[model samples]
Target: MSERVEWDDLPADLRSAVEARTGKVVAAEGIADGLNCSTALIIETAYNGPLFLKGVRRTDEPGMAALRCEERINATVGGIGGVSPAIRHRFDAGGWTALAFGCISGRHADLGPGSQDLAAVAATLRRTHDLPVPDFPLPQFADRLRTFLRPGEAQILQGSHLLHTDTNPHNIMIGDGGGEAYLVDWAMPAIGPAWVDPACTAVRLMECGQPPEDALAWLGQFASWRRARPSAIRAFVDATCRHWTATVGDKSAEPSNSRFRRLLECGRTETA
Candidate 1:
């Protein structure tokens, strides 16, 4: 997660553009849980109530592109029941591209072992797996990670199912009254096997104190998980561990590196 821009520091024209859609901005609070955006805030308008605003300067090509990708994914998945927030408005102005989503009065899911939120998380995964492939160009999950996988490992990553690759518990919002879990931040979506998202979730479960076997067991209810080939699972675990190891680099003492190491170890234990 990155520190975001303060509302007061936002460009006047961009603020105006957002306010145009939202009415007078009575209150704006920064949200500090996302990594790429230049700005992420919750705003309360005189008329529009509350909305979550996320934006990045056009100058940041990668960040800007991510925002646009999220917007597109939201639109495509918006009608697929209750998996994501509704996009209220999207616009570019003052050299910034931004989107406002209907605010979710929810908290980040607690993905630790035995947490009740796991059920909602599972349900969300089920609905997401059932969605038809979006009718737009998306990077193939296998192709995106081909360089990190062994010769035959990438084969299992190929499929038409839409995947939300970043399953950090923070990206999953559990409703205030224990309603449906909503997946947020759709920037890195991929088309892959339906099991990919749950596999990613399994990694996070390791982060949250479950061993790989227990984590996989927790997700056994998903048809995708039950039907996944053992080879594919091993490949996914190996490639993911390798990817994170490469990402964490020589800083083996770093906290993130330690977490990745645990996940890597879990994968090794399961497959050995």
Candidate 2:
């Protein structure tokens, strides 16, 4: 679970810096989602209206790096249209580094099987794959999960596609009226095979109630998925399961882990 930050608790300098950029913050509401961000808020400003703010202490290197990377990606990934919110400003103030984005008035997507949001999610993933790979160093999926993969498995995960590795339903925002799905929380973005992200989403779909075959079937519509070798797909499943196993420790007690296990079992059964 994530924690919330109160307006009064924010450092005076940080608040003043943000206010200088967007005008006085009339209201600040904590957004109680996303695990990595230390402080996530939806603020209503006197002049800017509503804007989303995410900040982290400079002492937290990983968190700071994620925010910086997000700012960089948002700056470079052109033609994304409304698939993601634009960064309004990024600044360092007080003891923290913060980013402000055009606020998205949306709700978390319902990724359960048969949900109408699935189409929007699929479209977003396809658009993401279509995005031109940025000319900067990004963590390669193969290198990130190498320890959990077999000898040749990591190679299969390498590509130039920009990947949003964490696809938890909460990170997908369904537009309030347009019904479009915007992918948020670019903290774990990477460069990998086009199939990799949709494959990850397949596991998430399984977590939402779709059986392994059905989940995989849904992703099969993507050219990348259709072209992926069976061996590579199996490798990805095994590595993802191992990754989550290390993350949650005991699968039986953790709901996320349990769902990952189900996805692993499905892959194992199909591969066997």
Whole-model Cα lDDT per candidate? 0.80, 0.79
* After superposition, candidate 1 runs with Cα above 4 Å error: 1-3, 211-213, 250-272
Write candidate 2's Cα lDDT for 33-59 as tens digits: 887767898999988899899998889
Ten-residue region with minimum lDDT total, candidate 1: 261-270
- Candidate 2 — worst ten consecutive residues by lDDT sum? 263-272
For candidate 2, give the lDDT.
Answer: 0.79
lDDT of 1 by residue, 1-272 (tens): 55579788999999989888889999999888988799999999977899989999999988988988888788666634748988888878989988988888989988886788888898899888788777778998888778789997787668888898899988999888656798999999999889879867876887888766677676667777666766666676666566666877656535444444333332333233
Per-model TM against the reference: 0.89, 0.89
**Roughly what TM-score does model 1 have, to 2 decimal places?**
0.89
For all candidates, the clash counts are 0, 0
For candidate 2, what's the RMSD? Answer: 3.1
Deviating ranges (above 4 Å) for candidate 2: 1-3, 77-82, 250-272
On a 0 to 100 scale, what is the lDDT of residue 85 in model 1?
83
